[model samples]
Target: MDPILDDHLHLDPVKGRGVEAAEEFADHGGTHLLVLNKPSWHYDVAVEAGDDFRVAYDHTLDVVADSTEVLPGRAWPVLGVHPALVSQLVERGYDPEDARDLMCAGLDVAAEYVEEGRALALKSGRPHYDVSEAVWAASNEVMRHAFALGADLGCAVQLHAEGSEDFTEVADWAEEAGMARERVVKHYSTGGVVGPTPSVLADKDELERVVERDVPFMMETDFIDDPDRPGAVLGPKTVPRRTRWLREEGYDEALERAHVETPRLVYGIDTLGTLA
Candidate 1:
């Protein structure tokens, strides 16, 4: 089996399948994962300050440890303030500026985890939907803060923003923050997005289209592991399942790039590394 990896996933021991979901992915041939924290609200955290994010980040780290215990270092954690948290903070009574500041503070906490080696990446981005201009501006500010943290830590920043083929501004921000543009990955990528390196969704058609490019890319299930939604975003097994189909279709070289090579380059971790 190849070193299949899901670039973005979330586990909720409280509200989702959590570690059990890791078993499913492993059963289907997935060898590793880049597991990110769900939104702050998902953990019942109301952000009054950056420290509020720790409640969620700690849980995510715990989940990572537990999943790794089962999969033997197959899981690494990415901690951050989700883009939607800005609005959630606002709706929950935070002034816009306060909400933005709190989000930045949240990223600071996440960066500490990365510096301490408890996590490998920081996640941040503007909301993907329409919003008031002020809110949008604030979200961008928080994202910039995340890039700065990534630069300081020399770690990757996983971005979750509106879907687009281009991310020129995001590249500019990453460069300004002293983070390599390639280190900024676009989560939920549409197979062939431009600018940041893509973590393309593990769709058969999408993977097939991007594999031929032979660029730095990885495939992901983006599995939320929410029992309520069952397979929201994508399921735990999707990446491995799609990878198997791709292999049978004779994409060995490209699959190696996606499965092993790209992950090593982008995350500074070898394919399943010592994890497997």
Candidate 2:
């Protein structure tokens, strides 16, 4: 089989981290790495690594535009308003009605602020979506308007869903927008407080559902490492642990086979280096 692609990673040496981790990854033959733009300080390490690097940008175009100028190739930023921050906007005493109007006003001001403040982090980065609430609140007309802007920008929208409702809602929204599944990359982690943990690594029945749907989603292991606290991710240590889960769940061999036999089997990883 070919070398494995680690989808997510970090590298920031100035802080006495990232550098060593990145070097270790290089030595370990990790080819492609997904580096988020959030920690702008880490851009150096990712840039120095060259074309093997890809940036996961947030929603703003200016942020991504600046980064693209700085680092020519390998930039993919997903576009969408952050669902998590929606509640925060309300908490800040911004009238809900007014805030909704501001958001609907073309994401111009928000995009500008995001670019100026955290350009490296937001551009070519992922903006998360709250699947359940988005569906529950948005009218079909509102949903179409939002998706039109996102799709026109040529960025994938990363989704976070808790239950079957979340999952189905997203799929329905994509259909409504007339966007291909390939344009939407769903982020599936372990079962949340309310939903069933996705069987990305186990449960053939669940995995089959993903395949059957022809969804344009990728498998990303969202793990955070803490020296003082181990097993924070609820799995074993090292990449091998993830690989083992994939194998045990009949994913590894199958994915490799698909890569060889079938045409396109899209996948991604979250956080590769900089565990500091």
Candidate 3:
């Protein structure tokens, strides 16, 4: 069987089940996972200026690196600042302006990690639709900065915005930031949204449409690693199961493109580097 890669997932101790989750994913045929850092309280404080953020960023790298002990070459790291946390900070009494500043600073740290080979990509994007326009705008600004930074560092930027059928706005943002549309990935991408930009889809029917369009995409459970909600968005084993289903349905070519080829092209993962 060809190895299945999960493009987006969290494996942190705070909100995720960490190493145990990694073991479970591996047990279920998940070969490689792009472990993203969530905007937990420690991370929020770590994004602040000074040596604190740097230390936090380094710790993030350490945590991701440690996942390899449980899954070997299957673990890869994606570091970034989540934009939704801006609203959380505002609710906690932090000034909006200060929150924006911290977000930008966090992106800078994430870009540095990409440059240092500590991570393969950076994740940042707008919050949900219900957030205040001011918060949304501030998050967009941060995303712009992140796009620019990713462009400069030759890294892909995964966007965590609301699900939208049209990605023209995000493509425009990438263009305005002088970044390549191909380097901009839409995270938590569902069947509803379709485009050329790389994305990770959860639904098989939607995955079929994306493949039919010849879109560059991958599969993800967006597994948050929450023990209480275990497999909240989708189970850790979901992608692998979907891959098997596609194979059975005779969509071998599509599965190969989405599960094997696209990840290698976007994240530069050699087949030999994946877990056996």
Candidate 4:
């Protein structure tokens, strides 16, 4: 496969399970993987791997230090705050204003290159604004903050926004917020709400829109389909099918080609090991 560069790769852990899976992938011509540094499991793996892979911290500042010390010249620390965390704060009785500020600060601390808008258990069935209003608000604030920082932080916020309707609203709101149109990138599923099929995205012209606008769109292989091993939530059988479909829709091929051709394109794996 010509040493394909996977933008996202998630590792599963059972003692030495996850990192071993990553090592196997590396051995098999995988160029780099983006590891989401979240949960106790991932933290343990990142601290262990050092620079062997790229790390994206879910909600921590210490990763900045690790990236500085380990990866140095690269954008070592990548950050993403869990929307669920915001939900947690709300549940804990924190004032909305205080909670929003704290979430904004977390985004600032890690210089998060991406944002994951996945559902928190409590916020899942509730109204979008009520369930994740604080998250959405904080996300908007961080967008402004990133612009004010005057650094092209090269961060791409990944919203698990479900479908086209919410996506349009989010994109429209971000545009109104003056977020650089070129910088805004949508995460997985481009149509119908939540995990839309590739056919849905391409059939509706969403992919063309993203390409024409040059938004850094990416899809993740979130630990469900493990190539090295099976039994994941979504592994090779699932993720690669989507990747092939996206390629058919004219998405760039691999991270290396994308880096050279469409530098804005990014990839990640939402699992234990880092993507180099």
Candidate 5:
């Protein structure tokens, strides 16, 4: 069987089971994973500045190194500053411009990791709701900077944005940033948007829409690995199990498109090989 690729997950040590979660995913038939950096608090980037940004950036690289030790070729790292963290900084007395600068600096660090092949992609986007307009606009600037950096580094940028039926704004931002729309993955997608491929959660109903559209996209459990919430979005085993279910139900074409072809096309990852 071709390996199932999970496009979005978190291997946070403090809130999550970390390597244990990866092992569980493997046991369930998942072979490739894109693990995003843990939230900003893990490195205190929102509350501090200067060297703190470097420390926070380094922490994500450390996660990539450690996750590789556990999952080897199967685990790939995605580094970036989430928009929620940007909002947090703004609320904590950070000027919006400074916050944007901090996010850009973090993206620069992530770009280095990508250049070195220590990471596979960059993540940046604003939340769907709860952020002030000013904060959202500022966060968009941060995301634009990330898009440019990703373009320069030849890496894909996975976006975390508000749930919406239309993604015209995201596509516009990508264009304005001089990045290709194909390189921007809309994470946590509900399978509603038409343009700019998305990485959506595992849901049979949503999968129906995705298959109907025949769009380029991928599936993710968005597994947070939180011990307290324990599979808050979905369990580590969810994607593999869903892939099995889809295959059994004769959705082989859709399964292969999302689990294999699209990921390789978008992220330039070949999960069949071992990581160096």
Candidate 6:
């Protein structure tokens, strides 16, 4: 069976279905997942400083551990500070510069986890929504911090930013920071990304187009596993189900390139191979 990897996913055992969600993914033919840490607020962690981000990051690793107990090395944690946090700190009386410092510290903590091999990638991006110029500038600096960390650790950095397809500024930041362009992934990508690798959202039309491209790319559901949203971005089984659908539509070669070749090139995971 071809390895159906969901490049981005989230699971919560307390407020949402956790390991059971991973089982649902496995049930639908999914093989691996990059389980991302939910934003700080999700875990109600107080972000006074960088180390405070560890509360949420630690929770994410715990969730990955629980999932891996069953999946057995099929799941890995991706840790980082969410960019929207800058605004939240501002609203709560934190100076914008302080907020940026705090966010950078958070990424520092995340890099420590990556160095410890507790995570496979680092996650960071500016707010996907709009903010003031100061906040925006600060957030951009925080993004550079992540790119710099990616360069140092030689790990992937998942970005959750606001953009259609062209991430020219992001690309420039990564290049200036010395991070490999391919290791910078844009989560929830639609298609036609120019610089960073688009972990294309698991949508049929999007995949149909992206899979044909010669560029290295990936697929992700970005499932937050929030019961309240009940499939806000996409359902948990979207990736594997989409894979099966694409296969039936005679996209075997495309599947090989996207599912096996690109993942191998980006993540260095060897379990996935050419489509048989």
List, residue by residue over 175-237, the lDDT tens digit for candidate 6. Answer: 888877888999989877878989999888888778767678888998988989888678888
Rate residue 138 of model 3 by lDDT. Answer: 81
Off by over 4 Å in 4: 1-3, 9-16, 27-29, 39-77, 112-154, 165-169, 172-179, 191-217, 224-233, 236-260, 263-276
Error of 5 at 22 (Å): 0.4
Q: Report the alpha-carbon TM-score of model 3 versus the true structure.
A: 0.89
3 against 5, candidate with superior TM-score: 5
User: Of the pair 3 and 6, which is ahead by lDDT?
Assistant: 6
C-alpha local distance difference test of each model: 0.86, 0.34, 0.74, 0.37, 0.78, 0.84
lDDT head-to-head 3 vs 5, winner: 5
Superposed by TM-score, candidate 2 places the C-alpha of residue 233 at a distance from the truth, in angstroms, of 4.3
**TM-score-based ranking:** 1, 6, 5, 3, 4, 2
- List the candidate numbers ranked by lDDT, top first: 1, 6, 5, 3, 4, 2
> How do the residues 162-244 of candidate 1 rate in per-residue lDDT, one tens digit apiece?
98878977888899989999899999998778789899998878887788777888888888877778898989989888888
Candidate 4 residue lDDT tens string, 187-227? 34443332211112222244444445443343334442234
State the local distance difference test value for candidate 4: 0.37
Off by over 4 Å in 3: 42-47, 50-59, 195-198, 272-276
Superposed by TM-score, candidate 5 places the C-alpha of residue 54 at a distance from the truth, in angstroms, of: 4.3
Candidate 5 local lDDT, 15-48, one digit each (tens)? 4687778888877877778888877676444446
The window of 10 residues in a row where model 1 has the poorest summed lDDT is: 267-276
* Residue 152 error, candidate 3, Å: 0.8
Instruction: State the displacement of the C-alpha of residue 224, model 3, in Å, after optimal TM-score superposition.
Output: 1.0
- Model 5 misplacement above 4 A: 43-47, 54-59, 69-73, 273-276
- lDDT, residue 184, model 1: 93
| Candidate 1 wrong stretches, greater than 4 Å | none
Best by TM-score: 1
